[model samples]
Target: MRVFQLGLLSALALASVPAQADHHQEASSQQAEHLDAGRWVTLGTRAGPVTSATRSQPANLLVAGDQNILVDVGDGTAGQLAHLGIQTAGIDAVFISHLHWDHTGGLAAILGLRAQTNAPPRLKIYGPPGTAELVSGLLASMVPGATAGYGVPGAPRADIQQMTEVVELRDNASVELAGMTVTVRNNTHYSFAADSDLARRFESLSFRFDLPGRSIVYTGDTGPSAAVEDLAKGADLLVAEMMDVDDTIAMVRRNNPNMPPQVAAGMERHLREHHLLPKDVGELAARAKVGAVVVTHFAGREVGDPAHLEYLREIATNYDGPVVIADDLDVF
Candidate 1:
């Protein structure tokens, strides 16, 4: 029942340009020392594929006992890490909840940067069945850069394949990762019929991380899902995505005024069924009985808009636990 917001000091220090750069380097070193203590940092909180003026895309960093794991590598994730005084090469592993472009857009940057730097301890990417193919394609794209080797004549070419390892996870899969036990459940983001080939091929997953002294469940992007609730049950923290259905639909219509009415209607249905509204989030939190909730992956409201507070109010109606509407860089 306690609530706190972190990264205030970092935010203040980052406001100054020259001073911030120096401080960031110092902080990065300091952060490395305490990473084994375990914490969750919301690297990017904005929802969907479109960029925002105030928020970055959907990404999070999980620091679990000497492991730096990226929960989702959305676009701008590398930049978000840089802003927090962390380097892309520092990420040891990544857990992708789904294969949506918005969730996996930054994989190229993470892979490319790690390859360019020739960092040791090859990165491990854990995701759904198609993840290997996704990483394979990204690795193929890096061949030219690896061959160039910064224009150094006779220098050994970087082996991009050696720099990354992909582990594809399926529904109800569990694995040990860097002293943490990671489990995943298939969620309702995609409504493919069970027992169908499409269902077997594609899945949207919710991940539960059981770390030393803490348990966290991340609902990547899902509708109201009993599987997600079961995955999150009794967890220490539930980092869930929340959507403002009406506002999001409005934003979509505004952006595509020429879109057909039927198309818009279909989109609305998808948003309603495939995403969690504020109240849905509250109910899930309540049902899961998580100790605390940190809401990220926000959509449908402008940054600094008062209307955003309505989400908190709606969530409060069902859940009495500590709930935080997180911003980029917020740690919990």
Candidate 2:
């Protein structure tokens, strides 16, 4: 399932810049992997909370037999589902990778839209500890506007309270639902000191979904983690987040040229520790022996960015498996 390869040395700084000649290689090979019926489809691939012209924030749709599940509900998730001709009400459950806005931004929309139509008994949402509180806050903020149709004359009342259910998943939690076996593990995305409040209050998670004959692992924004590798071991597909370290630093510099040295250094540290570089991603996938890797949550990748080919080459250095640089709506 491998695509292209390179014998070039691992050059991070130089690899950040796009090469005009590499665009054709990407175009020719980008569609190498195709989604079979009832498989995974990438709904959004962009990282960060900000919306970009190239990709959506971070979301994916999984069709396992009769079940329709959402991996993460990022911004524009509803629209992407509509674009894919999937009904919002048909989602059996949503797995929130973490509480980051980019991963949970479309949650309210999902709740509201489904309630607008034939609401399910309860839309199950699984996430870390703060999920209940987060949903409470969202509902509070949507008081007047989102709840306006609750009791309109000649319209069926929508039960905002019972319309959704939040399930907080802890590390090592395993469950069976939606015709799949779901196992969860905590990842090292939010790295804070053990005694710090941030560490105590925030948790990042990765999920593994096992169907009858296939397994998929979604590594929600994380640095290199043994837990993630173990969870994704021998998976049929690994959907992961990848960042270009050099490009990230360059992007920060371009945005804030006059930023303080300490602040800039901190930004670089976060990029290195909080996100996966292409090499790290490749090595992780290789070590896990996953059948293929579908890279989402692109941090510094732009549409038609030729530097992305170098990224693929970097991944190929370690992984001999297929690496699909996913765009919004790409299915595999």
Task: Output the number of the TM-score-best candidate.
Answer: 1
By summed lDDT, the worst window of 10 consecutive residues in model 2 runs over 9-18
- lDDT score at residue 9, model 1, on the 0-100 scale: 22
Report the lDDT tens digits of candidate 1 across residue range 95-212.
9999998899998999898887768756889999899999999999989988887898999888777877888888899999888899999999999888999898989999999876
Tens digits of per-residue lDDT, candidate 2, 14-105, equal: 11101122534554333222212235777888887445887887998787666678988998899888875666887888889899898999
Clashes of 2: 0
Error of 1 at 183 (Å): 1.2
Per-residue lDDT, model 1, residue 205, is 91
Residue 150 C-alpha lDDT in model 2? 58
RMSD (Å) of each candidate, 1 decimal: 5.0, 8.5
User: Which runs of model 2 end up more than 4 angstroms from their true locations?
Assistant: 1-38, 150-156, 252-266, 302-304
After superposition, which runs of candidate 1 have C-alpha atoms over 4 Å from their true positions?
1-37, 260-265, 302-304
